[model samples]
Target: MALVETATFECGGCGTCAPSTWIDYDRLLYPVCPEYGRATGPLA
Candidate 1:
């Protein structure tokens, strides 16, 4: 059996969240928000 820690990454004030994308160069755990676009920082 396996467990997942988090389902999605959320930015503050968005009220929504999505899976994160691996940015190789910058090495950031970030999400691509539809309404607000890409997040500037990783989740805290």
Candidate 2:
């Protein structure tokens, strides 16, 4: 059997933020604004 893991992203700002699916990555999740690329967060 193969192990499959999944994760989700929550926008640190308002719930209205939506990030681009194309740029989705592990490191980019933190300190990034969902609507715009910026440093700020607790993305875990």
Model 2 per-residue lDDT tens digits across residues 1-44:
99965544455564434444423445654445545655456544
User: Candidate 2, which segments miss by more than 4 Å at Cα?
Assistant: 1-5, 16-29, 42-44
TM-score of 2: 0.31
How big is the RMSD of model 2? 6.3
- Model 2, residue 26: displacement in angstroms? 11
All candidates: TM-score: 0.32, 0.31
- For every candidate structure, what is the RMSD over all alpha carbons to the true structure, in angstroms? 5.4, 6.3
Per residue, candidate 1 scores C-alpha lDDT tens digits across 1-44 of 89877555565647555554422122364444555665545452
Give the Cα-based TM-score of candidate 1 against the true structure: 0.32
